[model samples]
Target chain A: MSMLPRRVEFHEEGPREGFQMEKGTYPLDDRLALIDALAASGLRQVQCASFVSPRAVPQMADSPELFARLRKRPGTRYTGLWLNESGFERARACDNIDIDGKVVFYVTEPFSQRNNNCSVAENRERQLAWIDRYIALGIPFEQAYVVTAFGCNLGGPVPVSAVTDVVRWLVDACADRRIRFPAFYLADTMGWANPEEIKRRIGAVRELVPQARIGLHLHDTRGVGGANVYAAMQMGVDLFDSSVAGLGGCPFAGHKHGGAAGNICTEDMAFMCEEMGVDTGLDLEQLVEAARLAERIIGRPLNGRLMRSGTLAAMRC
Target chain B: MSMLPRRVEFHEEGPREGFQMEKGTYPLDDRLALIDALAASGLRQVQCASFVSPRAVPQMADSPELFARLRKRPGTRYTGLWLNESGFERARACDNIDIDGKVVFYVTEPFSQRNNNCSVAENRERQLAWIDRYIALGIPFEQAYVVTAFGCNLGGPVPVSAVTDVVRWLVDACADRRIRFPAFYLADTMGWANPEEIKRRIGAVRELVPQARIGLHLHDTRGVGGANVYAAMQMGVDLFDSSVAGLGGCPFAGHKHGGAAGNICTEDMAFMCEEMGVDTGLDLEQLVEAARLAERIIGRPLNGRLMRSGTLAAMRC
Candidate 1:
């Protein structure tokens, strides 16, 4: 009756996601220190920065320098986020940053325009062009992200058909190019997912592409991120993208208040997975230390709970 | 395969739980305002105060005055917490406070001594005396709370047997007195529950007393509180005790940091339930306003998400 996975993979996104949304400008050394701490905590992949316009996201303007100065850990992949071809080129220019060909499509048009300044159809065409370039550059296709897969803040209550349509499009595009279909990541960009909605969406996507591995990019914007993760795991989803200390919020999400939560906390999710007898391969103590360091660097309290409560392992000790 | 209840009941404990854990002394009017706001938000039961030793919880020393000046909302039951006969007497003396006899036992000995200042065995004896008093006073017995039902910070992981033992004791005690067995509320006094553990423990308790209703009093100390609530709902748990704006942390739980979270946020949980199509008989906008009011009174941002992110219903409109 239990559909839980035996192991779960987490991609840490605190540095890129957390800092970009923050109003204050942090020192480049502080950013690198946070990423280094995350990598040292045994996170296999740490999203170090976002390669976007400096005028738009002033906090992430030092993406290239951050990767250049990062103390890379063995067995860890340093990654970055890029929305357009130019941003992708910026990431590819950095030798230390991991470059894998990835495509993204928005589930809703309003979000697509606001987040990427392009229509959904236009974004699809852009992804096709990127696919051709990836094939030519010998870069392995990593995954396609379906942003706002659950529901959009600008456009409410996304239909499951909309999500499946994007997945179907990705499948057809890969097939047309004679390339294998990569994994798919369903992103709840605005924290609009409930547990049942998570299950329904995952089931729908799985029904369409049974062979593709599905990952979740959830936000705790409305306090159900952990439940959404649990729901996905019950459907055997093993991949997650989380932020350390629950650090990042999307500045474009149109939240009225300053306290909009970021992605589900990395150490909190890892703690949940490990406590349920699932192997996360991350040290709780190290992650706790990283979370605390992140809080100290930010000079404010972050939304993470494990950093404050201490791990149950410590209590057992 | 979905076992979620069609309608869920929530008992708001913000005024008692949130304010007691808060360090600053709030005005009595502010406390009454919060309770009134919670009741107006369509919460059926609001726990306004705790009748404990003033020396122990100075914040709640004005419980009697709080009840006296409370603007009673029709069809809403204003309740208060009491752990002993003296506390019970104080609550009984308040004409406006809804008095229902409740019993509590600790799953772990260490938590029992620290939280209630008595051993588990001594607490059981005290509960027996309280039961006799309830019978003598012709008061209706409401429920029995199994504190630290999941795990204890001081005593480590609690066995499922430890939980069932308390449930069995409660059932037997009611049977001995020829009274109907009351509902059992499992309190995660320390935030140690995971989703799998929630299912396993709820299943174990149900097997022992199939007819008795079960409620959960959870803390979001280390996150996963929402997931635990969802897991319990999958087993058809309809009753929950929550704090508004996620206010309140146990002063005795030994959290090193000041940012320890309280009970799961009432508005956030209600938002989750409503979004999932479960009727919670509460207005989301009203609850959100109440949560904001709580934040203002606490003079800090509370750990709720919906108050910041707004609601899907508003977006759809």
Candidate 2:
């Protein structure tokens, strides 16, 4: 079997997922600057912000305001995170966002209770309701990110069946709403995935819903983020969620030992794909500069290595 | 092609290369303690120390004394670094070392001049002289590490022919000395190798000398260390040189942007192999603890991720 794919695409989450975990709230100007930097770096999809309750996620309290102020860059796709009707309406109110329906549903009880303050079954019902509401509003669903699809911190050992069960249910819900071309993401919320586990889970999801577009939202908590991506690519996966400077992991994402800091570094992932002869269509040198800008904004070094030591291609160039 | 090997082996260099770049000299007791910890951690090949001059590498100044004090463990092989005949003589004087010859030669002019303070030709001549001295002493020559086999920081690009030339010269020299079964290592000294470079060089070496055993000494500076290892394994390489807690970078290894910290983390390498269903014959948990101890001794966090985020096997165990 081929060890890699010919091409890959990434959704930049630095402004949304990356900023969510920071201790201090970045000024709206800095957030817009990061989004602009990502746009200039050739990232097609940028998850700009989450319209979550400001009280729960104080870091993103100004999501709507930031979205209002962000100068939409041409040729760039912008989206926002939404978990409920209120969040969806907030995202819809913004002119900057090009995509509206972004939903996160927990696959396990412990994670649902811990992060959402609800049980898994309740979260599933709420997700269905939101899907119907989104369809009623004529908004095409972007992606239904299945949070903690691999495993959870409090609810450990999430079986493959549990994950596929959620996917199958989501498919049924989408059909009920007459929504076609559904896309789902397997989010390793805690970064608790190995290559075998990634292959097994992705295989199970494919077997159950072959028609659904699948993507991975991986965390580098265990440092296997790249390996897991390679494994997924070998199984024909190409779409992924990453953050520049590898920024952000919800404070809750911290393990008993160390924080699974940030999503897989965007530049690192792009560099890996580029090195494997996979076309990423990203300006990696610019991405590295963006990561540096992020570090300057955060006033501390982030967890990305590529920003520090550049790509071989860039070095040779 | 299969993405991995069935069995992979690692030569631990935390005690040697890891310490060489540290700012303060670790007291002899601390050094001995780390070695003992490594010995107990089930590493088969532990690179103990370098016999370089104290004036140059004060961290390794007490190599002979430390070697004399080590309680050698059975089932574990010990080795030391030797850049020339004088360093080889010092290693020869030690009773702890199992493999008799260890040599590092540069394949690029920039690295040879910058690192060794000599031209590539001069370094090659000295390597041959050292090999003759080793053969005269009846010491079996082990691995001839081809530094900058992939690319160099100062030297923009190292052609595959440069790598194959050095490997071919080392093979012919061994034959002329009546030495058999020579081993060669493709060292990405500046971490300048990508997956393609690794494949091209290793493929070239295999075509030129199919009988020669090949290994990789990779650096994770570019975050592709694991990817490079996977790429090499797909081409049939199973032996690697790594440092515990991913330590070392030859104070010269740091770039203007970031310090290129050490080799691939030993536990990360083992974890990747183990996750892919390959047997590393290592006690990964013990190795992680050894890394922790190294961190404690260094009084700072090391570059390893597995130590911070426990491995899947260890977590399950």
Best candidate, lDDT-wise?
Answer: 1
lDDT of 1 at B203: 93
Candidate lDDT values, in order: 0.88, 0.80
lDDT per residue as tens, model 2, B191-289: 777766677788898998897779999888767777678768778899999998888754344476767656988988787777678899888888888
* TM agreement with the true structure for every prediction: 0.97, 0.92
What is the Cα-based lDDT of residue A136 in candidate 2? 75
lDDT for A59 in candidate 2 is: 90
Q: Which residue ranges in model 2 land beyond 4 Å of their true spot?
A: A1-3, A117-119, A175-178, A207-212, A250-258, A313-317, B1-3, B117-122, B209-211, B250-254, B313-317
- Candidate 1 matches the true fold with a TM-score of 0.97
Candidate 2 local Cα displacement, residue A211, angstroms: 5.1
Among residues 3 or more apart in sequence or in different chains, the pairs in candidate 1 whose N, CA or C atoms overlap within 3 Å are B248-B262
Which pairs, if any, clash in model 2?
B247-B262
DockQ of each: 0.73, 0.44
lDDT: worst 10-residue window of model 2 chain B? B308-317
Write down the worst ten-residue block by lDDT for model 1 chain B: B250-259
